[model samples]
Target chain A: MSRSALGLAGSLGTTLQRELQLAFSSPGRIVNPLMFFVIAVSMFPLGGRMSAEVLGTIAAGVIWVTALLAVMLSMESLFRSDFDDGSLEQLLLSPQPLYFHLQVKVLAHWLVTGLPLVVISPLLGLLLHLPEAGYGPLMLGLLLGTPALSMIAAIGTALTVGLARSGLLLAVLVLPLSIPVLVFGAGLVDTALNGLPLTGVVAVLAALLVLAGTLAPLAIGAALRISVH
Target chain B: MLTVANLGCERDERVLFDHLSFSVANGMLLQIQGANGSGKTTLLRILAGLNSDYTGEVLWRGQNCRQTRQEYQQALFYLGHAPAINRTLTPLQNLRWFCGLQGFSDDAAIHAALQQLGLAGYADIPCHQMSAGQQRRVSLARLSLSAAPLWIMDEPFTALDKQGVAELEARVDAHVTSGGAVILTTHHALQTRHLLTVVNLDALRTESA
Candidate 1:
């Protein structure tokens, strides 16, 4: 409707485009987490050589846990490069509120890092010998849950962005908060395996996504400001 | 029309500067001078709203900068110590995003700004391939591309050679003569059309004591 409003929307897209550019330019940035998710989950199956029954039950836990870690591994770079290169300061000085820009940033991250994890997840499930009934819930759950994981990792990354050697701090901050996503996501497959109704689990995962989408940005915006300061 | 009133700041239990007060208006150039650790960068960051640990207030058109952040930021441009260029990104891409944050960016303006900073024909190359000074120019390209009235720069001439220095000095001069204001910290002696307003942080410290 107005010039500033147009620019506000324009900046968000521009931020997304820039983030995608950064992520794609270094293909390893996107690929590493995917590899980690695959390799680490693969370890679960080979290490124990368990029977199908046992593997099927624990598959969701292993997959959800690995996916959560994959997002965190990819998430640290969300703001670290910007902070190191001083673009974080520029971001802080922008006239538009940081909330929307942060949403766009995490969205780009999800597109690059989270989407790939979702796509190859069934392959990982197959490797783990997941039950046929559980496959649908597993994919559906990750598709819904990983966005919330990405946002949580974004907050953790922003909180420790100012410090060097922040990996442990990132885990300490993110893993605890991620318990809800892990619980609900893994439970979806478990519930489906038992031939339970999917509506309640679906609603909870959707609510977590919505809740994270709205609330995480506020913390992310503040964390970025303090980090830059 | 920016003003600072009785500004004071401390870091690590040491008073870097106290009771510091100055104002920069249209068509004026203010240079902040001090020895190492005198807080020139911190002062600039405070004015730019990057640091909030300071005492006193910064006003943009007589309104508290904190309360009027959006309007104040829209009217201000700041270049700090780091070049702010992503090594993996090309100059064109970097400037596009930088100007986009301020809600204005176009290829024509970005190219012209790069050329102004002696970066002609170098826009497409990734910044990591460029030399340090060239990278700095990529960051400095924001000077011409922005319409904000007040610019606060810290050590903008850090890696520049003679020509780069002269080019930046001329750019700063043109900005001030055209009714824009600039506050900068640099070792390079600047010869501009307007008289320079210099603030020495060491002097402020002594007066406070």
Candidate 2:
């Protein structure tokens, strides 16, 4: 590879490391989201959900909503720290393409927060009394769907970084955007629960990932440009 | 050589400056003096290719800066009013990250630069734990590591003490002595006895008005 290619790779790697370090540094940040996930799943059992049938019927929605909320909870830290401490200005002034940097940031976010949600979905599914056959589809759907959440959440993170109460504002901005991922993800689990072929739902989840991968960076870059002004 | 011709900058309908023309050749230091809120920082941003809302032509080596932004940026190092250091990472980490972005992979040079900035002991310490002056020094350390020919700094001495100010002045002198060009905005009267040109933005604005 040429020198520029090496530099770009290094930039991405360093950014990924920094993001992971920030996410896991204080237990407060990571633990809160994990607790939120557990509590959300537990709610299914509390609301007359002790029966396996009752819990299994609502398992997919519970898991999807919990994963979505976990991602949303962690998304605010994406650009807030950089913006607050003036590192965002340096990023904007860098000689490399800012869009490339933004992409690296989004990827890092998925690796740190979204990847964990995928890894832990099985445990949450168990709590909700998910059927054995639904496990694979749930994890698969989450693996494909969570990155879409990250990409969509980045747009909201960039837009609300300049606002005073950006946390609540971010949820308001991103929840509407995350509906497609929720639909496909939950649809896959629902299909599996009913003994129906999940090929269609899985395909839609993949399509959503591709669509978000293509368009989310442009939206994020535009939002950063507006907010930095 | 760098030249700005017919530069006009505005923010949200308020005209900061208009029809400003300036030129600096090799081995020259241009000090832009202006009062608070006089658009000095805005002018520097326009020069550094970060702000595009302005109307004018900034020519570098006879090439239009706006059209050849990457090429121009490759030759320019801009330090804004805010010290752009990541507080979570150690100074060494921040430097390594920045060097990586600039396509530099030499850690020895980065270490040498940190030492030169009197930050050798604190290189591995996160910037958030350092004092303001020390954090500012980390930003100045880039001046030693970068090979860019043009330096644009906004209030580089704002957080520095007397000793730090002198240290920064020495760095600026050394840079100018090596045939590099510098454009800086400052409230302090720089005591450099080199070939320096002072552009009073307040006077220029009054004349233009």
Candidate 3:
């Protein structure tokens, strides 16, 4: 590509690297959400006196809900520091489209936080006595579904990033948007365990991801500009 | 060139400034003068197209800035009131990321700019360890590295000592001499012996009132 194009790619790559660096440098940024996901998932068994069969019945829903909440827990931090330090102004002033850079940020967030939840879902599945067949579908659903959660949560994060107490508002704004992903993801495991063809629900989850990927950046970019103002 | 036609802003039902108009041509400096909370930073942000809650037009190169945001932003650099430095990152790392966001990257140029800002040995050290003025230098280092023609800085002189302030004034003078334009807000009396236009917001506030 030409010089400017190369610069755009380099900028995205550098942003992704910085996101990872920040997340790792402050271990709490990554660890807190992961712990929340694991602890929240593990709590279902403790709180309920259900047998393995009944637990298996609710495992998919529990895991999916916990993952959604874990992702939400990490959302407020997405743009908070950037907004506080005036880097959001720098990003807005950048020649590159804010859409592209914002997406890179969301993608990196998913990779750091959401991907870990997906990677460890099978172990969580075992703890919840999720059926053997449910593990594959659970991991698959999370892998395909969580990007949309991150992208949707990004818009809410951007909107509330300027607020001093944004956690409740973020959940209020984002949780509704995430319901479809939760439904499709949690249902995917049930379909797989019953030996039903999973393409329909899988396609729905994939479509949600694609739609979020395409449209969220626009909302995110607008929200960021408003927040900066 | 940058032009504003009857620009105005209000915050929390209070009029900050109204019917503000000014222009800065190539090789000129416009200083926004006002006391604290007189909306100097708000005016600069409106000019930089960061704040949209304004009435009237901000024309960059004879076109509405919002209409051609990409081209407009490409030629514009904005430094806000707060120094936009990440405390966890080293000065070098911060510059590298800033340059990358500006759609370029060069380690040598970043280091040289840091050195010019008197941050020679603090390149690898995290910003939290540096003094407030040292961290401010890291933010100001971008001015030396950036080639954007229009520099909009809000309180660029903050946290700098006397010598550092003088050095920054010289740099701004050089920038104007090289056919670049600047709009900035400062409490310090700038030593720029050039085509300087002062937009006293305090006077404008009374006029609008």
Candidate 4:
């Protein structure tokens, strides 16, 4: 690898490793979001009948909403620990591009918080009596969509990171931005259930992911600088 | 070289300091002294290019620091009031990650710096298991590991034992002797015999008031 590539690889590898270590070392941090997703989704079924028709009617919407909340629940943590402990200061001082590092952080957060949801969606889909055909759309949609959710949530996380308690404020700031993701994610299953072509919905989501992957990091980087200052 | 001219800052509609100006060149140690709430930390933050809400020019090598941010940051090392230590990670892991964030990773050098900071046997132990001073030492280990020409430290002596304080002072002194520059804030008196310059923000505060 070239010098710049080596540097990028080294920094990216270490940061991802650090994020994973930090998340896993505290089992609560890793478990809380997953549990929140499971519990939140499970509550929906208990609130109503066990009929496949009723469960399937709500599963797409319920799972998407719960997944959104799960990501938001873990969102405050994206920058909170660093901001509180002064590592954020060091991050701002780093010679490497803040945009790149911030992107790495968003990716790490999705891995620990959003990836599990994607992996377990089929099980939840089954629990919710979702149509077998809907399972593919649900999993693929989340796989493409959650990263965007994470990136958008990161903007709010960075904006409010300096505040002592910003969880609610972060949700308020981010939820509006998350509407597009939620619409398309749930719409994926909805389209499949309707026997319509799902490409248009997935295409939009992929575009969103790409757009978020390219742009959100810059906003997140700028927002973190403002908050820290 | 770092230079500030006619700087002014206000917080929550209260003037923290105004018309403050100072400069630090290679081989110099400029200690910023001030009472509580006197803006020593804020001043250092401005100089380090972390805080830009102030009014004035912070010039690096005769150019605006903002325009030359990448180069400026490349040559700068800042230690904030907090040690930036993560409780879950060992000192060695923290240092390695910190260096990696700066775009390099050297395990041997990280170990050596930890050893130099009197943390040889404590390298692999998680920071939560260590005393506050030892945690502070882990942050201080970055001092020996960094080759940045400009060091901006805020209250670096906090939680240090007498020997740790002495050792850090010696490190700062050696840094200046080696043609690096340092801007630091400390309530504790710095005993460095290097080319020391003092910028007391308290006097600036009172003068502006």
Candidate 5:
């Protein structure tokens, strides 16, 4: 492989490994998000009297919000360690294009944090009494949407990297931008639960992912320049 | 090998610098001296192709560096005030990543470069566990690993101890000896027996502007 291509691979590999190590080292990191997922799902039972009708209606919203929060919780780490230790500056200096490296970092973030959320989401789905039919579309929607979340989250991570106590700022910056992912992802599952064709919702989610995929790297790249400066 | 003509830059409604023009050919070193807020870093960024908000042109071998960014980047390595080493990764892993990014795939070359930097013993240790000087060494080790002709370093000597400083000076001298060009900013006077030119930004700002 070309040297630049190999560098890209190595960068992505190290990013993935480091993110996973950070996630695993802090039990609170995993438990907090898992708890939020469960609590959000469990609220459907308590708030709605455990009725199948109410549970069925709210399950999608509960799961989407939980998933969004879970992803947001981890997004701060995307650039924090690099910024704190001056690696981000080095990265900016690299002969390789920053956009390509940012894309790799975003992908690694999705794999380490967002991928696991997708995997365990079915358990949360069950907590809300979401039917088995909801599983495929819910998982699929997250599979498509969570990466979009990470890519967009990178913009926030870059913007807030130099700021003090940036975790809250990261959420504030990313949550509004993340609305489309939540909308289409939940819309996919909701349509599935309602016995409607899910193709349209899935298509929308896919389009959202593609759009985010295309534009977010540039935004994040710009944000990194500004933040570092 | 590197030249800037009529270079101008401004940030946040304040003019950082303007109409700056200079050139450094092969085996030469240019030191950019400036106060904390004097756009030294910004100028370095423009030369490195990271910041484009500037007027005029930077040329590498008579071609506009901005126009041929990838080519320019391929021929240069910029070490900023930040070390850029991934703390979680071992020094070897960090160098490996940088080598890959710079388009060097030979494992032997990477190991030899690390060994040359006196990091052979700490190659397997994570950067976070290494001392500050060690982390700095990991970043500086790139000087040997990369064959890029131009080096733009921003305050590279900031955190180094006396020994680290001496090691860096030796590397700088060796790099220039090998016909590489160096452009960097440092508060301390660098004693290198070469065609070293000083561009004092404080003087240039008032005189040139």
Candidate 6:
């Protein structure tokens, strides 16, 4: 009873650890998105009427679309389980800043869901007959960009977590916001394929990351407060 | 001190309750009484500052609860119908995370509280393995570990056994006597040494609606 509360670092570590533990226990969460990304990406190579060069041209668009869809599909679980289990209510009432909790949840999410996609994307890029120059940009772009997806999707998930059927509603709410990410994300690889310097593409994706990194937590926090009430 | 003046809340275009007012100080146990679909949970949610769509203001130490939210929330604990423990987590992990958010990281206290709740052996196992009442116990263990002075609980007694019910009543009595205020909604008749102040939501429904 005499024990005092912790500082920011202490609680953040606890929350982050808890989030990771939850992710680990639910292997389906990690495996499902990855499987979806791989399956969806693998299908494009089998479609008829495309030469290797033609497939190579659309590789950036195809990979980016699948990655975006995987992240978006996985986004529903970000807050959905917490909301259903009532842990979200306790989370909202916690004395700690909601912003910190949002950061930890989204960070854990990106690590488990988004990070795997980024890691395996190079292989998927290869399968699609990506131009040799596009490989490096594909991985780098996803590394910077998927966090933005996770963050933005976290906002949409927070907004709709209260609903019983959040299926298409979540996608509709998140896709419009995610277009810029898809455009710049695919653009990075496309520019590299065209033998252009990736300076602008990388810079834009990084800026988006920073913007989503700082601003996402606030929006998600407010949305969580609204949904719970 | 906590105060509510002219409080009114409506849900689904139906008036839940109106003109409700009350106050609580240290060492008070207030029970909210109402039948099904009554505003008992809504009232607790408003008092806990979870629901904001209401007519009146909730005051904490003479300031608006929303205005002084940080300080007010710092002193409050809320347990709703959901056990709130993630199914994938063990009792210890769940308590560690929950108490961690309240700014407390005392692992020993969490352990002792779990043991007191008859969960010492069950602490490390995933909560999905536990029965319904035991899962509820994992959440109730917070009542013993909480340092917050104000507690708002909705249907806290729903899934408890006889012993669990008795133990929770004792815990509430101890908390109230030790200068913490508890507001809860329950159909179970409580047996406690402290005087219970009942807020009947059904009667208010008639008076207002």
For all candidates, state DockQ relative to the true structure: 0.55, 0.44, 0.56, 0.57, 0.41, 0.73
Candidate 2 C-alpha lDDT tens digits along A1-229 = 1123345777667666666666666546666766788787777688772678878878988899889988888888788877777678777767777777788888877876788788888998888789898999999999999999989999999999988788888999999999989988988988897899988888889999989887898999778766766
Residue A204, candidate 6: C-alpha displacement in angstroms: 1.0
In order, the candidates keep a fraction of the true contacts of: 0.62, 0.39, 0.57, 0.62, 0.50, 0.76
Q: Write one digit per residue (lDDT tens) for candidate 4, span B1-209.
A: 99999899999998888988888899999988888888888988999888999998999999999999999998999999989999888888798788887787778788888888888988889999999999999999998777799999999989999999999999988899999998898878679887579888888777766
Q: Taking the tens digit of each residue's C-alpha lDDT, what string does model 1 give over A1-229? A: 1123236778887898899999989998899999999999999877976998888789889999999999999998889888999998998888877889989999999999999999999998988889988888999999999999999999999989999899999999999999999999999999999999999999999999999999999999888878887
Q: Which residue pairs clash in candidate 1? A: none
Instruction: Compute the lDDT of residue B174 as modeled in candidate 2.
Output: 86
How high is the lDDT of residue B40 in model 1?
91
Clashing pairs in 5: A3-B103, A7-B100, A7-B101, A87-B84, B1-B25
Candidate 6 positional error at A82, Å: 1.1
lDDT of 5 by residue, B1-209 (tens): 88899998878888888889999888888899899999899899888877778999999889998677778778888887778887777877677666656654555766777787777777788778988887888888888777888889988997788888988988888899989989999988797878778888889878865
Among the candidates, what TM-score does chain A have in each? 0.96, 0.91, 0.96, 0.95, 0.87, 0.96
lDDT of 3 by residue, B88-117 (tens): 888887887788887787788888888888
Off by over 4 Å in 4: A1-6
**Considering only N, C-alpha and C atoms within 3 Å, which residue pairs clash in candidate 2?**
none
Docking class of predicted structure 6: medium
Off by over 4 Å in 6: A1-4
Model 6 residue B71 lDDT score: 91
**What lDDT does candidate 2 reach at residue B100?**
65
Error of 2 at B158 (Å): 1.9
> Residue A170 of candidate 6: its Cα lDDT?
90
lDDT values, one for every candidate: 0.90, 0.83, 0.89, 0.89, 0.80, 0.89
State TM-scores per candidate. Answer: 0.97, 0.92, 0.97, 0.97, 0.88, 0.97
Q: Which scores better on lDDT, 1 or 5?
A: 1
Highest lDDT scorer: 1
